[model samples]
Target: MDPEVDTTQGGLRIDGRRPLELRRIRLRLGVFSQADGSAYIEQGNTKILATVYGPHQPRGKSVSSMTKATKGIVNCQYSTAVFSFGAGERKKRPRGDRKSIERAQQLKHAMEAIINLELFAKSQMDVFVEVLQVDGSEFCVAVNAATLALIDAGIPIKDYAVGCSITVSDKLLGDDDSGKSTGILDANWVEECSPGVTLSIVALPKVVDETETKSSVILAHGAGQRLHLSQLESLRLRALQGCKDIRTIIDQAVKDHLQIFVVTTALDK
Candidate 1:
């Protein structure tokens, strides 16, 4: 822990947020005119752009052959710009690297879990995510951006898929009061690069009934450090809450976009 890194002030985090608070989220749908659907998202300093295309013919014979008549094919490509890093740092390639390939596969699976593949059987859905800035939790931000893009394309989905990252650190857990073991929600770049266990989770937080009881179905979980059995439950809870919060934000954004779109179309009519 950095001695200068102040953990909390008046029950808020060093970034002036509560322990379970997420960074400010800003998003816009239909960002690109040429793509079938596109969205841009910013979670604090991390910015990502995602585009969706197809539900059309498969690009090549290999893809066509693999396509099932009962289910749609989902293809995802995740890339980061050369200047995505901070000052004095640069990437050699934008994509095709080992990390990028793994992330792409992960994004594909996440999208597959939520989308109604049966409706687009024998067709392909292409998702491309580009990281314009890298502050932290790039994978989570990419997943969120892709979800918005899919919605913009009017793709049917069972529910919203949200992603969140958590970091478990004793330093952050200890408040001035009772010092209970806690995890930080939505860890930033500095927290992620610090010494601790970090977990990334993607889940669909569905509200089952009017009572507001929510059930979270986790689609993916990735860990950056070894976690103890005793700490797993707490970390999972925090991550789930973060996912739910993110889902609420995204749902609102989608609704707002639709409202504006409807008003614009009516005026043009």
Candidate 2:
């Protein structure tokens, strides 16, 4: 952490954002015509695209029945393009690698929690996320991307499955300092690859219902460095803020898409 990057003293930092601020966000729906639904989201230098296919026949015996049993099935495939600027200076296959498989599984689990599975039993929904650029919070960004795709597919979700990653870095000491820990809101590749602890959270867009029902947090993940239980609260709070910020941007995107959709239908009629 750079003292120059101090959030307390400095009024506002790069991008004119407060300490916990997120970058400007933009989302576009139906970017691809062939897929059932597709969306692209850009957050600073991080760019991700997601596509949905299915609510169709399941691939295997297990999947076919599992989906039909009571809820819809969400199959997620997460991959980064070999040419994506972030995967490090290398040439290699784009998907089906070990890392990609693990990412895919994580994504699937998170989505399963949000989607109303019972509605489309015996059917499958495929969500494919492709990283166009690499930044600190790829996994979280991919989750955000997948959420949009699901929405585009007209899938029913209790709430948006927003995701974000928080990094705890050392500020006072050198990069090696163990005691200097500062929690960063959203990390890009440089922040991610650095020595630190990262926590990923999948949270529902918080809502204050007059009905007096409390909101729920679905999934949380701690990776890289082990953090004390005491630190969990702060980390979770930061992650939730990030999720809320993402949800706002996605909400705008959805509205824009719907407006256009309505206009097109009106014209057709």
Candidate 3:
């Protein structure tokens, strides 16, 4: 863990952000007229495009086997452009590579958790995510982008499923050095590569109403380094908060876009 890259030092990070600060997220919905739904997003320097199709009959044999007995299946294909990486960074894997395949499955699982699969039983919904640029938190950005695309495609979901990442650094919770670890939110590539535990979470947008709760967390994945059991709760909380924040941003963006679209259609008519 190079001190130069550690954002958990109770100081601003390398990119001039506080520990819990997220990169600026800019997104547009329905970017492609041909697809059922499509979106483009930029989270920090990571740019991604997502397209959604289907909710139609499962045609291909590969898709047929994956269809659930009663609930429709969600299929995902994830890829990164060959030139998406920064100069001197490692080249990206080709499409259908093992890494891409695994990420595709992960994205698929996140989508399946919120989508009303029973609404289209014996069918399939396909989501495609392309990483146009990579800076960090690519998967989180991709998840958010896919969610927007699904919404643009008019898919009904129980609630918004958002993704966020948290990284626990050497910072201690209390005064002493031996205190419990403190986790930071929305890790960029530098923090992700730093020597620490990075936790990626996919969760439904948190609601204050206790009576309105079903499940808060949909998925939690740990990477980079091993974390102590004591830090898990704090990390989970931080990630969930990030999910809630992201969901708010997305919700506002969608509403703004729809208002603009409504005015544009009115003018055209």
Candidate 4:
């Protein structure tokens, strides 16, 4: 943590937000005509574009043989534009980099957790995510964008998969009358770069039955900095809340998109 950096300034973050508040999220689905489905999302400074192609035949016999007859294959590629970084310098390479490869794998697993792969057995779905700007939480943003693209593609999914980033800061909670570890939701670049532990989570939140609610299933989680086991549960809860909020926002966007599409089609007729 920067000596001058305060987690909460006048009950607001450095960017003028409450500890639990999220950055402004703007997204659009079906952004690309050629792809089976596509979406673009902007979470504060980080912007990503995701496109999904195919529920078609596997490209090779090796892929076909490996894919179970009851489950489909999910392929993901994560890339960052040369100008993604705000700094003047450009990147030497994007997709082939080691970090990018790991992110691509992570994204694949996250999406696979929610998608109903059994529905399209022996088929393949390719998701490609391109980061236009990266201030923080690039992986989370990519997952969200890919989910929207999958929805646009009309792929079957168990539920919406949402992602959120959390950061823990003791000083942020020091102002409280009762001392407790403070968890900040939707951390930005500055907070992410700070000394505090940053955790990114992707989860699915939905009801199972009237009397019983299914526990929020965490599809993926990545952590930075050492975090104590004692604080893990609280931090997970905070991150879950962030994920719920993001899911609400995304659900509304999907509804809005459908309404607009319906109205446009009616008007055209």
In model 4, where is the ten-residue run with the lowest total lDDT? 169-178
The true-structure Cα RMSD of candidate 4 reads 2.6
lDDT of 2 by residue, 1-269 (tens): 33334456454543355546677777788888899878898887889999999778778655636632776677888888887874456538678999889889989988898888877777788899998887667788888888888888888887788888787755311122454444777765555665667888888866676343233567777777678787778678767877877877787788888999999999999
The alpha-carbon RMSD values of the candidates against the true structure, listed in the order shown, are 2.2, 4.1, 3.2, 2.6
The better candidate by TM-score, 2 or 4, is: 4
Q: How many clashes in each structure? A: 0, 15, 0, 1
Candidate 1 per-residue lDDT over residues 77-115, each given as its tens digit: 999999999787999999999999999988988999999
Better of 1 and 2 by TM-score: 1
Please give, for residues 159-269, the per-residue lDDT of candidate 4 as tens digits: 988888888865443133556765788877777776668888888867555454344755656556788888778778778878877887898999999899899999999
lDDT for model 2: 0.75
lDDT of 3 by residue, 137-247 (tens): 888889999999999999998788899988876631211255555666787776677677788899887565745433388877888778888778877877887887888
Candidate 2 residue 11 C-alpha distance from true site, Å = 7.3
- Which structure among the candidates has the greatest TM-score? 1
Candidate 4 residue runs with Cα over 4 Å from true position = 1-9, 61-68, 170-177, 207-215
Q: What is each predicted model's overall lDDT from 0 to 1?
A: 0.83, 0.75, 0.82, 0.82
Q: Estimated TM-score per prediction?
A: 0.92, 0.85, 0.88, 0.90
Candidate 1, residue 43: Cα displacement in angstroms equals 0.5
User: Which has the better TM-score: candidate 1, or candidate 3?
Assistant: 1
